[model samples]
Target: MEAERLRVRKDNSLLRKREPIPFTRESNYSTPVRPPDNDELPGEKKGLPWPVLLFLVTLVVPWILPIGPLRLSAYRIVLVVMVLPCLFMWLTGKVGRIRLTDIVVLSFCVWVFLSLIMVNGLSSSIEPSGIMFIETFGSYLLARCYIRGPDDFYNTVRALFLTNLFLFPFSLIEFVLGYNILHDMFSAILPTFNYPPMAARLGLSRVQSVFDHPILFGIFTGSTLALVHLVLGHGDNIARRFTRTAIVGTLAMMSLSGGPIQALAAQVFIIAWDSALKFLKSRWQIFLSLLALATIATEILAKRSLLEIMIATFTFDPLSYWFRRLIWSYGWASVLNHPFFGVGLERWERPDWMPPSIDNIWLYYAVHHGLPAAGLLLLAVAFAIWAACSAKALDSRLCAYRMGFIATLMAFFLTGWTVHYWGAAHCLFLFLMGSGAWMLERKANTGIELKTDTIKRIPSSHQRPSPHRNAFTRRILSETKLQISRKELPVLNPKGKVADLLP
Candidate 1:
């Protein structure tokens, strides 16, 4: 009775025991998994963003096309290659995921649209204004993409710099060979301008590159070069640094371009001002000093004898100076007559009481766009100033580039006394616009609190450590087998009694 009771107790205890849990074998080595993000926007789906695309297009296209008198084939190529692609992508909702910069750019564009409509109705001749709107605004839109990052800002300036650098050798060759690339583009008043009558007289000489005219070439080169140095500074790049030095030396030796000289001087003033503003505490004092320096520089440049000496060393074209004087007088006259809007865009002729400037940028602005349009241009300048200041507030490298670009723009504005400077006028100005937009974009991305609309956590693939276990569980089957092998009971009996497995 006692043995049966003990057996029953053991059976009950065995029955109440919990079943063993399964164990998975694991090694020390593990390969990490980095899953792809599905939430990426359409624009970022592929390589190369939108802004760079636009910059290359506007810059290159106008140089290629055969629009009326302007055979802008090369320029057209740039537009086709760079700008159109970006515009197409943007229109198709493939780039720019509704950025704040887009909104800002769009707002300014809307203003231009309104101005275009107003000018189309108000102008005496509608064609010029209409053409101007299409070309200028299109250029603006294309250039707008470059304003997003410091890399873009620097790269755009670098590209502009290289284009001019490449044009320099061709210009020198054109001067030597007397083969005018822009011959068909212009109605040349003087064919023998390059071959002077006596003693290789370099006076009143203009050197044309592949551009529309010699003066246009000088203006474009001077303006672009100024912009390059203004934004980029005299850096260590072998190609650019050497190219700039050579061009400046050659221009100085030739002394044919007045616009470039004035531009260079103005650029110096701007650089000095930039340096001063950073170190000097008093803002008004800096401005006063800048004004004084600029006036002094102008007065010094005005002396004909000194000008001749300066140009004799490098040979800057003298025709640009006379051209500038004529334009300045005309610009002042236009300002006096119709100070408000000046003429209206591309309205070169005088309106009854209004006087007209030959090729003054300010005059161009006042006449073509009127005061409001001009104000918008000023706003553009203000935006550029804001961008420069803002860039200065960030890291030092960006600050240097921003300062250089700002100074370059200022130089161009000051040099606007001379040739029409259409290329430099728009390109450099638009560059600043892009830079400003870039800064704003950067600032917004970092500073502004972007609220998350939704949250979803994907599983991370990090392996968690296994829980602790006793060694006895691992050897349970082996121990059970050993006990069965050492049995101490009979295998079979008449009474049919079960035997113990262990001794």
Candidate 2:
């Protein structure tokens, strides 16, 4: 009886062990495992493609030389290099599918070409139109194709941070000495415009760094600050994050542009909000409430005109308000007259006292490209916002980064209302859009791959069993039945009597 009880216990243990095998095997094959933290998943190779590397080099070139030979900008030279290789790659069918955002950008470029031709005539508009198309649409396409995933995105952030760091000493020298060494060096080699001496504001000389104007330098620093913050927020090393943040902040202050100050303030607010309310159930509700409060404040200040109030509050110059007001008045009139395709790239008719260049980006676009092109630009921005909001990646840190990026975009748009960003400055906006589009595309591809894997794993109803498996199962059942019958049959013991061994 004792031996029999031990045998029964052994059998029960064996059965329990056997039962877990199938469950474990099923789970191993059926359920996907989450990747270990900080480790990239298999098959995702790191490193930027050559085109992306070229783009990064392009961004850095203007800072190094500011201008190239024959009065061409550094960006123009890089664009030529990028376009040729991209065209060859596309012709060879090596490029990915053309996204909707790409199409929209191309369409806007086409409209610009047609409008220029209509206004300036084909012969006169050819060079300007071609340059516009290449600079805007071509750059966007190159960015869209080059940035493939989060790795690329992070690499870009790192590159920008390094670029800012590299330019910091130059900026400091300019600030202290009231001279730009880079400008002087580049001017010697290339024919360049003679800019006025650095003007003192708030008891310090405004530093233009390597950029053409103080405002542009400030804008670049401000934009880089946002990206650095995003990377710092997601980074693991505390010392490195703080160091980068300090460098970016110092550069921003050196630029002495109100835009960077305002942008940095927005970034600080975002970081505070993230820290305080990130875990809250209705964090977005809190954000909306804050926005409502701001709107109410704006309404209360409307009696004095919000523009005047903003100028008084954020800017050092009081005359800026009257200046912008004049631009707006004339720009609106021009838009009203040529509301459709614009006045065909013609200059706005304003009094000689008024500035020729419109400071507002939206007004500039409307005056140059017409309301339709402006509308398309807004639509593209809207799409990018949607894509950023919708992107979901395997790395959990991506959500916070995306939100930070969106906040930066909002800040840029608001600050851009006071300044017209052209040339390379415009590329920053395009790069942001391309990054968001890449995230959305990656999310979509991941979903499709998951679905494909699932379809491949599931057995089809029409699939027949393999002959070997069928034969093996039948043989096992027959052997089990034979053993049971043998156990149930009567057996003769030493007493020569029929004895049943079943018990």
Candidate 3:
């Protein structure tokens, strides 16, 4: 017995630590055989695409670079430089099937040229119209071409968070010091326009960071709050998600701009509504019904327009609300006079002392470009949101992405009513709309079928029992890089077979 015990210890090695040899597939098929990670999947073989990274970096960088008489903005330069390649990709159907957004956006660009030509003759028109096209179509093209899938979409959300994370400290410093160090530093180095100290709002200096204006900075950073909080951190740790979101929200707040704060409020309201009544299946319909009732109640009780109340109540101050009311009243008049093709960049006649800057984006486009341009732009934004919502998600992560995408776009949509986006902000908005349109294209893809042996051969330890509706099936679909739907997964995993195959 002693001899046998010694032999067992020596040979079988009960006391010895054994290293686990991971399972490997015998088949030569290139399919990855691993369970899905909670956040990122196992099958992403490539790095984040370059076009996305380039544009995003360009976006946050300081805007103007003075060379001779012309002021060349970095975002526009990047957009213009990439136009040809993106256009070629579009022509080749590399950006997926062209949809209504694409058609309307392109048409809007054409109308801008027509309006400019009609007003400012073709010679002067070329420069302005061409720049507008580069800003609009170029940015859209890049997103359409490169941001093709859920992974790409999430990467974008992650990038936005990181970029803003980098900006967080600078924004705080700007607010506390009552000076924009980066803006001043960049001006010294580049011989750009030296902006005077902006007036304090809410007893703190408005933080512009590297953006052209504080409002722009706020809106741009606010754009990422919903996306980073909900989408990128969907399957991540709860504490970490809130921390990240708080950082982003604080960064946005440095600007003290009501437009972006309103945008953030809109997202929070939507998120709160969604969370509070998540148990109910038709929560959205109920919310809409409630909103309609509230609107009707306000209209009857307040003896004022809902629009007026919303604008006045949501602003940082009453004066801002009043100014915006004046803007709308006159901007609408300008639109009415030149309905089809509005005055092309010509100053719309207002009171002599009123500010020349148009604060509203929809009104800006309608007043300068035309109502058709504004209508098309509005249509494009609506379609982008709807397509993302309507397209099915492959898994929880993707569902979170759809949620974030909608929220971010909604923020932009709401923000546009009070603030005009130019330079980087404008491009980012168009790029986002273009990026989410791929979800519509995704719906057209047919699901791939996996042979039953693929699952059967996977060892029981590696396979988790997922029942009829399986997260594992979604994982498998992702692992194989296929677009297989949840409905068809039950065919392979029968009620009895799943347990029988386990051992």
Candidate 4:
């Protein structure tokens, strides 16, 4: 008996690759992306995505080499290599239409360059700013390019889960021993940053595993908990979901950081809230409204600002929260002083007793670069989240997937207030945020209908090609007076005729 081969009748956006069946073009012709030869490439590209590659590089290879004023890390090396291709993908519209977030991120990069140049000499600042460009925009674009849809998002989350699962035992051993074997082993043979081991809190020592710090290790592993349960957990047995969650959560707890705990608590709270209010379609809106109202109420009623109160409430240590409050006050004051271009790498003026380290990533950008630079980055994130929230998913799977991505991001938004992400964690955060780019483009309906041969035509892929590569698609859309998707589309039925491809 022969095995039955399943063929996809209609194209799905979630399908990793649905190469447009080639059509004859009387005008400028274009080729498909990386045309498969010798039948090696099949339904989907099986290798890890570039973003996952970055993720793995961060986890596996923390090798750092001192380069002049900066220390080079493995993930940054990957970004430096990937930035050009990433830019090419964005410009060619391979990912999707450019959203406000895309424009904001680009503007943020330029703003960072200008801020750096103003504070330091152009020669001195250009390299660091360019490095920032690679770290922020490059990582963002890489996620956008590879994680195209819900399926990719699920796979990415699965990869994270499995990786964390593998690291679980090691993290446990590291916690018990008060030493990170992986970090110790890596530092032995490779160039690694020296971070003194954190003090043991509550009889257990911090477990950093392979990352630079305990908080980093904790947050990186913990943030994926929501992504796992919400995306990959759907339609699966509760046992499996619990197992995966337990693995990730326990590993995160091994680091024994308050930020991870708070993030996990937030994830659980959202999950429970959704479960309780699943009947209401407007539940999320209600939650957001209440949250907003609470913020205003807190601002008016509480002695501390809402941010300060939230940080204090969420933090495990009251002392840490107080320290951060001081940082916030002093930090914003300095940001006000250098409102245009900030103090650059140079330390901001403060009372001699206050430690030099800025714990908040949001505040770090403002203090080190400028308020505008930080604002642009914040706006970009907000826009990305809003884009995801506003768009309609084509299916329930996509809906759940969006929830997972958003939940993880929410965790990061809160976690970032207490701890500043640096090195691999920083790159990972941007990459994860950028992975939601596809959500920005998805819609429940294309609003396209086909009645007969005279029906409108739209591109299947989301690439809005240039004149030469996709001239045929452009001409067809122009003639038919139809909207185009993000991918490059072709006129399947030339001579003003198209078979019904839309449902």
- Expressed as tens digits, the lDDT of each residue in 1-503 for candidate 2 is 69657755664554444222211232112222333322342114576566666665555444333433234566666776777676565445465566566667777778878777777789877777777777777677677667665666777677767778878888888888787876777667665555677668877778875566787777776776656766544655877776787888788778676666766776767777876886896886789798777767887866555555554566667676677778888998998988877777577868888868887777787887788777777677766677677776435566656766676676667666777777667766666666655666543211100121212232343244333333332333333222234333332333333344334
Model 3, residue pairs in steric clash: none
Position 365, candidate 2: lDDT: 78
Question: Which model scores highest in TM-score?
Answer: 3
Model 1 over residues 56-85: C-alpha lDDT tens digits? 433422233355754444334444355565
Can you give the TM-score per candidate against the true fold? Answer: 0.56, 0.75, 0.82, 0.78
Q: How much RMSD separates candidate 1 from the native structure?
A: 19.0
lDDT-superior candidate, 2 or 3: 3
Give per-residue CA lDDT, model 3, range 243-351, as digits (tens). 9989888888888888888888888887777778878979888987988988898889988776677677667778988899899999999999998888886789689
Q: RMSD to native for every prediction?
A: 19.0, 12.5, 7.2, 11.2
Error of 2 at 133 (Å): 1.6
Worst 10 residues of 4 by lDDT: 34-43
1 versus 2: better TM-score goes to: 2
Model 2 TM-score is: 0.75
lDDT of 4: 0.73
Candidate 2 global lDDT: 0.64
- Candidates' lDDT values, in order? 0.47, 0.64, 0.75, 0.73
Q: Looking at model 2, how many pairs of residues clash?
A: 0
Q: TM-score of model 3 relative to the true fold?
A: 0.82
